[model samples]
Target: MPEGIEARLQEFDRKLRDGHFELLRQFLAKDYFGYSPGPGEPAASDRITDLVTDLKAALPDLTVAFDNIAVDAEGNATAEVTVQGTHKNELWGVPGSGDAVGWTGPVSIRAIGDRFAVRLDDLATPQRVGLVRQLRLVNPADEMDQPPHFPVVWPEFLLRLVFTGEVGDRPCSHLDQITVSDPPVSVCEQCVESDHIWPALRMCLVCGFVGCCDTSTNRHMAQHYQETGHCIFRSIRDDEGWIWCYEDDAFFDKAMLDRVG
Candidate 1:
């Protein structure tokens, strides 16, 4: 590591130790993105600042020690940090347990020119989960139950291709490739034939066939799935942006739906 980078890390420690948050912001890149695991987007400066302030209020004696700092030639660095604190107040909607906890976790930082952006890996360990539960960040019942299905999916190969493009193993339906049906086909094509109304509509990724969603009276989408074995469908309504796979029982964000359409 360059002496300058090491010095910067030391300065970061000092600023955090003194609760100099505004001073810390001066060291971060303007477009910083940080990863946080629970319920929010990756952290930017404002988000991290808010979290730090809330944590400080809840744990007045909180302190951290950074170790195993490793910097690459490209100005990216990572470290493991040991954190100790006492739960003393409400945080993230959870009332404090009034207990002291200590843990170690990893942190990563990337430098853009002289400024840096940081990401913290707050994985859900038993201790961390317990702490968050006590803090009310999550419902205790939901935490104790089986976790829901994974919410995000990005296939490893062909990741560079835009999702709306033709890069998936499944061939695009001839109708989809030709032109999307005008007016977005708000009604399910099959439901109209059966003289039934559907609550929602789903479009087949492979064939652009509009079918009623599973909740609809007819469940045309499931029928389509059974008959044609077309695995993926997207909500035709503009309100939702998720694609579902019947075979995998998985959901994909539109950006990762390249394989289907």
Candidate 2:
């Protein structure tokens, strides 16, 4: 933890996850520099933002629990986080069937001066990504289609097949956490919408409520916990989705699971 930077970094993830772009822009520098191979088929800054936006929609209660944050004396910080949420909406282009999916990946951020200047990384699980590539088989966008801009041409079920694995054969219990903007008080969120917002966000074995990816902006997923005092959510949209808990104020990993029980 780096003094105020740790909390600040967490706040940034929340803002991005919450679809608070204005806040993100305010906290980040106008001319920031970032580098990574992510969402954009072409991988550009805007595409990265779009990808983040999409992820938010996919997992309304999406939370990026950070693993480590390193900030130097120069105010430059790089944090590694695992984005957890659900798949409840349209990803790529196909409509998500409110399935339980989760993605496991890392995010890299760069901070400078009084704000972050750049950030990049792929956030979805390799399985979901493969599904997207497979989808390209149908409605292939020219290689010129920028990442975050290209569209997947398969049904949402393919993602489940590639990511969720066989129902009982999951790597971990308390799988994917669904997220929504305005849950029905009963369900944390829904991902049936084109934007990945499931009506009811599922809970994992650890008792956290993560949301779908950026598709539906199921902000209510995190909001539900914040309102009800629950933490720990997984991306229900990625096959390898992980956990994010506010109590620990961090993301879940193998070590966490070891300690949780």
Candidate 3:
């Protein structure tokens, strides 16, 4: 192991564990790059700082523990880290459920001068999925009931369909419930009133109510479904005409209308 590398690693762990995020700059290179799933590009130092800040805000009592740390003579290091926290605020698109959530993953660190560049394990997808599950955004029982090959592709529409039973035998149970197809407004009214911006829009098929998609911070569409039992909604953004069923957890292309009719 390189001289002082282990001590530096320990200091880095202490800084993060103690929520002294500002001190992290002392351990990270000026051109530090961090890698994780989702964004295809490496995250710059500023983005990494923002992410950690957001994480701390969401989990007020967040804890990070490093174990099995191994350092090589060339200043390359690997360690297994476990993160634990209680969901006290909204994270990603899911609202806080006050659930204690934890995930363990491997991380790599390479010393560049006195600073280090960190990269999370590429197979952290399961950890993310598990985190969402812990937030109660996904139901394991419902997932078990889902078809083996869910979101099956329909060649005619070139879109995926997630439905139960044989496609030829019966259509989506919510398909016939659609009472409205056209949206009356272009903007998410809730977002506008709340002074928030939305990335996309969805209109309820049952009541023609327009709201923001899940990607939006407000997630007005999901709130509308929970409050009104309105199960289906269609995208009103761009030319993408896909419909989603909140009850069935399925997706359907607008072309499905022509096929069934």
Can you write out model 3's per-residue Cα lDDT over 54-145, one digit (the tens) per residue? Answer: 66787888877678888988878989877789989875545667888897777777777777766555443345345445655444533432
1 or 3: which has the higher lDDT?
3
Specify the highest-lDDT model's number: 3
Residue 221 lDDT, candidate 3, scale 0-100: 94
| Candidate 1: tens digits of C-alpha lDDT, residues 96-183 | 6788867666667776556666655544345344434444443354323222122212221111112211112222233233233223
lDDT of 3 at 229: 92
Candidates by lDDT, descending order: 3, 1, 2
| Runs in model 1 lying further than 4 Å from the true structure | 33-43, 121-136, 139-143, 146-261
TM-score each candidate.
0.49, 0.38, 0.49
RMSD of candidates 1 onward, in order = 11.3, 17.4, 15.5
Ten consecutive residues with minimal summed lDDT in candidate 3? 161-170
> Which window of 10 residues has the lowest lDDT sum in candidate 1?
157-166
